[model samples]
Target chain A: MAILEVKNLSIEFGGLKAVEDFNLSLEKGELIAIIGPNGAGKTTIFNMLTGIYPPSNGTIHLDGENLLGRKPFQFAQAGIARTFQNIRLFSNASVIDNVKMANTADSNENFFESILRTPGMVEKERQLDEHALELLSLFGLEGQADTIAKNLPYGAQRRLEIVRALMLNPKVLLLDEPVAGMITTELDEMAQLVKELREKHGQTIILIEHHMNFVMPIVDRIIVLNFGKTISEGTPAEIQKDPRVIEAYLGGGFHGNA
Target chain B: MKNKLNSILPPVVLVLIYFLIQLLLSKKILNPYHIQILMFACVNIMLTVSLNIVNGFTGQFCIGHAGFMSLGAYGSAIITTMLFGGMKMDPNLRIPVFLLSLLVGGILAAIVGFLIGLPTLKIKGDYLAIVTLAFGEIVRSTLRLIEPIGAARGMIGIPKITNLAWMFFFVMITLYITRNFVYSRYGRASIAIRDNEIAADAMGINTTRYKVIAFVFAAFIAGVAGGLYAHLMTFIQPDSFSFVKSNELLVYLYAGGSGSITGSVLGALVLTIIPEALRFLGNLTNWRIVIYAVILVLIMLYKPSGLFGGKEISFLRINRDSFRKPFNKFNDPKLADKQNS
Candidate 1:
């Protein structure tokens, strides 16, 4: 059975349809890439999946649980976590705090428990710190743990975004344009890191990327979208060879019609 | 265990500080005027810290703190005077009863805070600000209409149970609780909501739940402050808790720095003393208010984040070792992160 299944999912803003008939059946530990031009409704799918925009029609199931009516935080609790196209760390907060925030809902200690400094609560807090620090050290953010998030260099901020998402303990991680703007070296490094996440942790990831260089090598399957509909879906080689995918990226010639 | 020792350390230190202040009082080292100023500053600190939870930690602008304070004042004052029916209680039981009444008053204001926060789920930013301002005005007028609580004439002859000792204890409690809240998981969620509502929501943080908690908690503390104020003055009028008073509290919060506990303490204390300190100007008595305005403007312009911004005192944190390497400054977290990352 698929870990995540979306059938006939659609959304409309007034008279215009932003996305329609979005269907997917994603197995556990699958890494799929959703690629498209500027307005192909890729991000829109992520929005609906993360509960930012509820679907106008159809049902979404995460490991057999209906996800239609759940709130955004409920979506996260149900094991769906996502990063934005634009990095959205808690900018005014410390770097560690930004990561630790993902685990807040799961931290069971109450206000009085924390206030009175109960031994068990303090131990729990220590574990949280250790966990956050562990994640930070993995990304070389340990030394910068106490620094303000917004002041970090651009690449670290982007890394912290994904790191924070992972801290959510998600079953299905959504990466929206993870390599939006980076020099070739930085892009390659980020791509390698994401692929490593899947290899080492078996992290199930759905990637949306414009940079084909970043997308082509890492993703196992490529799903192409144009005008809010999936135009092609296949292995990377098949997607590279498909005529419709070519037409979507570069407009087809019309000599015969003329 | 060492941890047990550490846990007890803060309360023990607090008690020691209380006794030290009491010693000064008993020794007659400080004048009565200075004592009055200190007590008033403690009240303002409570108000500032309470307001900071909503305005600073949660990043929601609340202009109706004084309304919650008013409710608290009226609730407790009535409990002692009207509910008790002027019957003299045993002296030994009086303090506890008074404290319980103050708690009841705080709870009453918190109920209203929760109600106001319900609408805030739909409203945001400037609209929330307007809603809170309206709440303050509505509370004021409603008090005026209710003749049982002295109406527009104001209440009088309430017992003056608040003293320097009680003020110090409550103010310290306010500081301890608020500081703990900011550092706790729920408090972190509140800060996350302030940072980015959508992102915080995506991270499984219930933005509304934390927001309302921050609001209600702030209102509860303000209510406590109101109880203290009512006892201190032995009187309270609807006019005292107007929109202007709310703004006055904001001035202290902003001038001291919004998110920092030390900021609230310094802001409330220093700003409280400035007006009286200006009395020394004699003929330029009115300039005291202007000086305050000038100081606020200066703080706003030169240090928009306020004096301390997001930082706090070292010892206030749970981990004593967090600030151990202050002297070397070699591994400055703020500067080094930009270069390393």
Candidate 2:
């Protein structure tokens, strides 16, 4: 069975349909990329998946459990975690704090325990700090853990967002433009990291990106979107040969190494 | 042993300070007027620090804190004055009763805070401010219509039972609880909500829940302060907990530094004392407010983050190792070089 299944997903803003009849069936540990131009509604689909926006028509299931109209945090609790296209980090917080904030659902301390700082609560907090530091180190953010998040370079900020998302221990991880503003080296590092996340941790991943080079080499499958509709879905090599995807997004003069 | 010392040291210090103040009172080094100012300062500290939980730490604009305080004041006063007014109770028993009444007041204020927060906290920025402002007016106007608690004319003959010891105890509790909440997971959730609502939500934080928690906790503390205030003044009036009182708390929160607990403490203490100190200039005392206004504006202009700049004093600091480790590593040239490479 698929880890996540979305069928006939649609959303409308007034008279205009933002996303229509979007369908996805992500198997466990499968990696996919949603490629589209700006305003092509790639993010709208992600919004629906994460329950940030309730779809006008859709059925979404995570591990065979229906998740139609839940809140965004509920979606997160149900094990779908996502980073933002615009890098929505906790900017004023320290780097470690930004990651630890995501562990709210996992914490079991009650009001009294927190107020009194009981032994159990103190132990839990220490463990959470250690785990957060471990994740930060994985992303090469251990040294920067104490720094305010906004002070980090753009690439680091993007990675921090991913680290924050990963703290949820989601069954499905969504990376929205994870390597959006990165230079060549940062892009390569991000690609390597995403691949490592999937291969080593078996993390089911979906990402939205415009960079064909970045998306092609890493993602197992590609779904090209145009005007809120899926234009093509296949392996990266098959996607490169799809005439409709080429005409709509890549243009006639474009050539791909794949 | 070190952990045990950390736990025991603060209370010992607080007790010593209390005795020192008592000595000053006995020696006539501090007059009743000075004591009154000090007591008011304690109440203000409670008000400002509690307000900071919502306004400063949580980044929620709550201008109706005095409403919560008023509820606490009235709730506790009714117990002491109307419920047990004529009874000749033991002085020792009265202390417990007074503490119970304050707790009742705090809980009452917390209930109202929860009610207001649930509906209003969903809205952000200026809208929340306006709703809170309206809520304050509603609380005041409603209190005026009620006949039992003196109605519009106000309640009088309330016992002045709040002493330096009691005030000090409550202040310490307020500071300790607030500091704990800020350092706890719950406080981190609130801070995350303040930093970025959308991101915090995505990170599995129930933003509304944390906002309401911060609001309700703040209200509870403000309510306790209100109870202390009523006992101190010995007279109660609906006009006392007006919008102006709420505004005064906001000034303290901002002037002290909104996000820092130390800032709140200092802001309330200094602001409360400055006006009293200026009373020596009897003729110019009225102009002292003008001087106060000037100082506030200067602080706002020169050090906009407040005197502490969202940084706590070492005594108030929790997670000491985390505090020291971050800045040193963050500013290290070798770390920067490593990140670049």
Candidate 3:
């Protein structure tokens, strides 16, 4: 059964249509990649799916529940989580604390518990801290937990973003340009983490990626977008041979492999 | 063990020093006028430190801080005046009553904050600021229309209970609580939202909930300060809690550096003492206001981040690295075990 389903999704800003008739279904523990040229509305699709923007039309279902009108945070609580294209790691905070904030949403902790520091509160905090650190360690970030997020190297900041999202323990994870700024080695490490995140954590992952090499290896299937609509959907090998996919990337004049 | 101590030491030391100095100054060194000036300084510290939680850490501009203060002052003053008005109680008992009243005032102010914040959560940046400022004005006008509290005549005969000890004690508590909060998980969420709301929300943070929490917490502290102010001045007036007073507190937070706890404390202390130090400009009170304006503008132009620029300062070493030789590693297995378990 599909874990997340989007039907006839459309988004318009003022008079302009930014996304139209976008549809996709994600199954449990599956890794799917959405790829397109610039302004193909890849990010817009991610935003709408994550409740950053209320869709102009259509409905989204998470675990068979309607999800069109909920706020981004409400979506998070409903088991949908996302990370931004730009690295947003709470720059002034320590890396470990950055992930710890995500754990706060699901924990049965409150202001009184934190301030009073009762035995229950202490135990809860300890468990949260451990979980957060384990996530950092999964991405080889345990050593950087004490450093200020912004002060870290650019590659580390991007990794921190994924680690933070994972802290929410969501059923579906949405990543926008996870490999946008990484060096090749960093991307490879990120791929390993993403693969582990799916296989071990059992999270269904949807990523919007421009780097075809990164997407081709990890994604179970690929969706192609062009001018705010889904143009093609298939396995990686099938998407690579589609003529429209080439046109979307390099205009109609060129003939090349995707 | 050392790592745990490092996280909790600064706020403790700062509060201890504040009370120690208050005790020493009251006993032998300072006169009543100086004591009054210092009392105001403590009040300013509470206001600025609390304001920093929203304006600095959460990145929300709140021009309604004085409204929260008015609610707190009125809430506590009415309770104090009504309860202790005609009774001949021991002077010592008044302090506890005053503290209790302050806590009550803080809670009420937090409720008002929640009410205002509910409608304004969707608004951001300058627009949100205008809404909050209008709330402060609304409170001012409403107070003016009320008659039982004397309205324009001001609420009078509030029993004076804001001694040096009480004022400084609340100030210390405010500082300690705010400092601890900044280092905790809530603090990180607040800063994350402040740095980038969109990203914070995407990371599964309930941004609206955290924003309301920060605003309410800040308002509560502002209320406590207002209570102390009412008792210290021995008068309560709507005009006293005006936009100018809010501006005064904002100036302190901005000049101190937005995210630095120590900076807020220093800003309050320095700004409080400056006008009195310039007593030579007696009839030129207008010049004092001009100078204050100039100083604020100059600081903004010269140091946009203020004096400390969002960095913590310590007079003594608190981190374990200070004692451990060659301790440059970013992570320690032992530290990780301690944090986890």
Worst 10 residues of 1 chain B by lDDT: B320-329
- Mind giving the per-residue lDDT tens digits that candidate 3 earns over B243-331? 98888888899898988877788888888998886777878876886786688788889998987668776522123233232332334
Among all candidates shown, the one with the greatest TM-score: 2
TM-score of chain A of 1: 0.95
- Compose the digit string of candidate 1's lDDT tens values, residues A4-30: 999999999896788889899998889
Query: What would you estimate as the lDDT of candidate 3?
Result: 0.81
**How much is B262 displaced in model 3, in angstroms?**
1.6
DockQ of each: 0.50, 0.54, 0.42
Q: What is the interface RMSD of each candidate, in Å?
A: 3.8, 3.3, 5.0
- Decoy 3 TM-score against native: 0.88
State which candidate has the highest DockQ. Answer: 2
Candidate 2: docking tier: medium
Model 2, C-alpha of B290: deviation from truth (Å):
0.7
Better of 1 and 3 by TM-score: 1
Native-interface RMSD of candidate 1: 3.8
Against the hidden reference, what TM-scores do the models get? 0.92, 0.94, 0.88
Question: What value does the interface RMSD of model 3 take?
Answer: 5.0
User: After aligning candidate 3 to the native by TM-score, how far in Å is the CA of B194 from where it should be?
Assistant: 0.6
